[model samples]
Target chain A: MLTLQKPHRHVETVIHSEVLIDCRIENLYYGDFRAIRDCDLSIERGKITAFIGPSGCGKSTVLRCMNRMNDLVQGFRIDGQIHFQGQDIYHPSVDPVAVRRHIGMVFQQPNPFAMSIYKNVAFGLKLNRVKDDIPGRVEDALRRAGLWDEVKDKLKSSALALSGGQQQRLCIARAIATEPQVLLMDEPCSALDPIATRRIEELMLQLKERYTIVIVTHNLHQAQRIADKTAFMYVDTSNSSRTGFLVEYADTHRLFNHPQQEYTLQYLRGEFS
Target chain B: MPTPAQSPHVSQSNSMVSNHSKRSPARTSPTFEVSVVSPPSTTDVLVDRGFRGLAYVFAWLTIVLVCTILYEIGGHAFPAIQEYGLSFVTQSTWDANNAQFSVLPEIWGTLSSSLLALAIATFFGVFIAIFLTQDFLTPRVERVFTTIFELLAAIPSVVYGLWGIYIVIPTIRPIATWLHEHLGTIPFFSTPLSGPGLLPASLVLSIMILPTIAAVSRDAISAVPNQLREAAYGLGATRWQVIPGVVLRTASSGIFGAMVLGLGRALGETMALAMLIGNSNQVSLSLFSPANTLAALLANNFPEAGKVEEQALMFAALILLAITLGVNMIGTVIIDRTTRRLTGGTS
Candidate 1:
């Protein structure tokens, strides 16, 4: 709702795709510990952007910042600005709940409410007062998340009764039911097995057609397989305390094949600190 | 003169390894020693049997205690039951002068007073649970409130009775009169506040059980994992939407169990109700009128009762026991099922 007009847009960004989220982060800290710094990136609309890095590289931290999820953490502070739909999400006038309604997120673990599967998907619609046909919207959202058929017959049963992978998909369905502009996923497949992981990877690819997706993944191969653009971040250990910063951002093919930085190359080649 | 003691200690430390080898026979045995796993000795068998016998005796002592109480109460109640038959419970009059007694009014008093207390306690207890569990207040303030709840539970019932007689009666008498004046047409507020009555007793009972309901509801609410909160928030839910919509719904059964437990405590409260309920053997719909519960009736008359009065009082005690015990059993079952269901696992 608030306009941040000081910074100009990054020109020639990501295949010249329309910029959906313009982020300019100078520093991020939690109670005196710096997590990430100087990470500026633009998320293109209807595109799958992957962040691949090792542990503690702030890949998840950066992803959480997109939806303002980090605001829930104690003493979490950000010297940054993020604009979505040409409005600054962190402005005092802009409510975090309203920001989340526009930008949804799925965590690393599958967290379904104890309610029935139907209620889980319909929760957001009811909260946002989507006066449209609720049952129809729930079915459509589940269908888009690729969980409808498996759950259609037992829509009234508890969501916890579903398997691990199905519950994760239900979480995805719950997130997308509100029809958010962007879906931020923080290692959505980390807790799942390989089969479940592959099915979700396919689901992500399908979902990218409608929603702009930003995923932080430790799986290099998975990112290479699905992402259209990839940003690589590495832990900056030049000082006494190591913190994460962006090393390279480009098309997935260019970043994988001919990386711009030696850190990116070493990370791709399995060389880690 | 004592210098040789240090020299002896140094010699023992120097040869500690050799001492262990000589002292421990197990060190020389094979890795698997069959003798070490041999059958129990005679002393072990005797000790085991003696311990088992003592445990069995203690277990049977509890059963015997329960049976003794049941037999004594039933024996004394036989005279009243034989004379009055089923009419004893349905009849309205309790005339010890004519050797005629009934328990309907006492039953009404017990149920109405307990339920009224439960309703009031539940209202305040649930709000206390929500405000305490949610991260709205400073943790220091939350801790202070939690300590107050525990202190409320720790206070003696007799003290509550004294407070009810001296403080609660004088305080609520005016409010009861105002309601009776404006709402006299309604049966609940029909009568004027006669000295000690159902209204004051019920208020004191609510204060007594408020801690029970609040503590149980707090545990149930907190048991809900933060993951569910995250899930709800991630779906764009505001705090108000999330509290009743998600958190309360998830812990509903547990909170119900807590109310049931509070009802159990209210049903069996004797001293406080005895002091405040006026010990009148009459029933009326007006909460301002004096009434007597089975617990207070038994507590008040048992010391001065003659033969027939004693028999009737014993009957009252039996009914009180059945209601309170049954309520407690139901509460325990509900709490067990829901806590296991709510906290089974988190995704």
Candidate 2:
């Protein structure tokens, strides 16, 4: 977590390298309306974890809670604990900005800032005041996101000029620029075409070599292709609460090939979308 | 476009208006017909055409009014233009006792004082805008402050002049005198405090125009998409960093448009400057020295002027008109451009 927190450096804390982010969300709420309940998930270091669920199942909501992105939302409150690198992210003294610095995010929409491509990618470094080889780091980040070949020549041009795919890639480059340990993507390629989605899936696979990834995807095939671990979630509409909860959590292959919970099996069998 | 529920009845032969749907039918609403659609009446076409013609005339009135003003002022100014040529503007000497007139000093005061006021207003207006938009205050409290700022514009300019005379001048006089006495070497602070001068007039002018700048800037800052703020925060930007770096940068062009619009308002300010600027005809660098603006010149000298003085004042009026119109045109263009750009025009 990057903070102006006194004498505390904003860097990666590696207490247990295996589990980078441990989330045990008892309940999440938007004002009085409870959104999610009873979800305990561990995102391992350097692996792609895909969150697969139907719409309104709080997949994106839980992904956002990992990085404290929901703090910006009005009346958003969470109960229980999400410990990132052994520190409770919801602690009173913890700075959301610091948590965000160490863990970046990519939104469903490809929203590049109203600036040049180079500047969009370099936004994190300049704001975080990272005293490094800035130009070199920018080039590396762009190349890693696989956008350098397309946008390197037009670095100074407006990011808004890029195609949807290129802009999504630019966003990914921007997220990785600050060298965050975990990257939370909420339907990042949902807005892109099939080819663009394929490219991003490949990029995510490559990115997991260095960074932890938790993605919320509606496309189950995408989870089958790229995710090492998969979490299945369903909305409980029985008690008029309409709360979403985790139904199944396991290895992607085992969950798909083997039978577990009846709800999970019914969901996999296309009983209801 | 009217729904069946809106205008429930229709007849084949009737040149009449609706008792319920008194106005012309809407063109946008397309949903929720509780019953069958009404047949089109013949008078509907007539009413629509009539409304269009009326609106056309009203639109043309703006152009007609502008042309009429231009012709009247230009005709009155012809004598002065013939006597002095365009050099009437550049020549500084204005000896009214000798029937000689030039607007160089008035031009200086108009541009310099308005610009200084704009600079001061922009500083405070931007801070006020940021405070209003950033959720520092809740929506209800923010509306209260917004209304208060806007109420500043509702006050008459002469009232501002009165306030300047009674309050603003006296409040700053001690500091003005102290600065003049100690740092008299600097031209800006060289002149001793007086009742009315450029500094006091500009301070009041800044206050007068503050609402315009603050309101427009608040709209601009508020128009910035929330997604941009999220993107910046997701990149680890603190609240302060996101403000100046992302939010301000995104809204800069709109804020510039707000300044330009405020300048248009400031440039044409007449009654206040006439009363509070002390209406002197000399150009001086000191803030405490009295000066004259083109608006003030026209306001002060027009009623009692001889033939040539009236012509010269008309010329100054034409100049002021051109300046304010040109500024408004530029401001409109800038505001339009900012809107399109922020909406993500490709170029």
Candidate 3:
């Protein structure tokens, strides 16, 4: 049995080499409230995973934990392991800025900096020391997000001029322009109309073929449409403490059609009422 | 209504008289009211016409203010101009006994001291502003420093002059001595001090203007949007890059306006200059030498002036006014241009 464990360890090494994000947590806190309690999640390489939950269920919190964007908030902290690719992300040796370069994020609101559309996409590239041929790179990013045909001639126009759905796509294009291995989206389509939302959902499907995608969403239909794997979360109000728990995580079809837990069944049957 | 000017048909007196004196008082009154209600309506015209009258008065008052200032300065300086002509600007002679009052020395002294003060104030003031705005200090500490600087500004200029006389002059003497010994090799610091000179005056002026620049600059820098800072940091730029590229660039126009305003104040300072600058009459560019500004010279000699000399002093006052007005005008223009550019509009 000890010899059998040795070969399993080597196979595990091969499996981890293919993983893009490895998250381990003892607890995550936002001012003494444990948002995600002792949760461990690994985002697979080149696959789309959807985190589905009710409001305030720590889905977005876990997504922010991946990129360390939580560091920007006051009194937000996590105790545990979060490795990007293979390196310990929270270690003193790693700079948060450098970690963020490898792990890109798209926020719920489409925040393009107050500049020209082209400049907005090129902002990250300049900071990451890619100075040559910015126009070409910007066009390429826009094309990948399928926005180039609409905005190619008007590159110098203000980003605020774009529609909500187009702006969200622009944000996605901006994030991928830096060529990050992992992309984290927090309800990327919550503010978009159906057509724009459909476009983003399609874009996510295409993007996963090249990069790992982890999305936090409240819409179950959206998860069904785009996610390969699904994580269902619920707020645990049992101890008079506001916290969230991962109720179930499995292949999307099974989680939806053949859920095991009573709570999962009741939730999927819309029987929370 | 009656024909134009033919009013007897609807006149109340006519109706009352027609009713006759034998009628009862109530009956006559009703008849009179009915007659007046229908009378020709041509009596509602009254005019004070005061606005048109006041407009001329205000226009004349404005003209008078402008002309009086020009006349007072011109009338006093006319004789000096006649006697010394343009030589007053070119030559440095200031023999009060001989009555040869050329202004080259005083002009040079004023420009050098004021410029030096502006330079020193701008450096320290902007540094303090950036420090204050960037959260370098705690809120309580920031408030204390801000209050202290503002209080320094509110202290009367006369108090600053007195402080210069008793405290600052004596305290800085040793530093001045060291500078003279060490930096005397440099042409700027070559001259030796005799009691008080341009250096002491410039130091006092710097202290006076420092609060002005700092307060205004702090306001300007604080106006930069937090979004700009976040954008820079989000791109992996450090705190240093955010300040220079985002905060400072956004606030540049406002900061420039603040500095120019401080410059105008420095140029026009009076009491401190009168107190500390040795008031010598020479056009020496040397910082260590005694010198006089137009204001200081006017303060010093106006009381003792004869008719012609008084005129000369007024001309000097006029010159001082012109310099200040010019500086302020230029500052206003630059501020206008900067704000327009920042807001993305034509000024």
On a 0 to 1 DockQ scale, where is model 1? 0.20
Please write out the lDDT profile of model 3 over residues B158-215, one tens digit for every residue.
8899888888878877877788899998876778776788888999999999999999
- Name the runs in model 1 displaced over 4 angstroms: A2-16, A236-242, B1-68, B332-347
DockQ of each: 0.20, 0.28, 0.04
Fnat values, one per model, are: 0.41, 0.52, 0.07
Q: Write out the backbone clash pairs for model 2.
A: A1-A98, A2-A98
Candidate 3, DockQ score (0 to 1):
0.04
- Best candidate, lDDT: 2
lDDT tens readout by residue for model 2, A169-195? 999999998888889999999999999
lDDT of 3 by residue, A1-273 (tens): 001111110112223226667878778888787887756767887778899877887888888888777776657888898877577888877677776676778878776654578877887787677877888889888998989999999888777678878888888888888777678898999988889999999999988766778999878899999998888876666456657767777788999999866667767776551
Reference-based lDDT, residue B97, model 1: 86
Ranking by lDDT: 2, 1, 3
RMSD of each: 9.8, 9.6, 18.1
Rank order (by DockQ, best first): 2, 1, 3
TM-score of each: 0.85, 0.88, 0.67
Higher-TM-score candidate of 1 and 3: 1
Give lDDT tens digits, candidate 2, residues B318-343.
88988888878887888777755644
Best by DockQ: 2
Q: After superposition, how far is residue A243 of candidate 1 from its true place, in Å?
A: 3.6
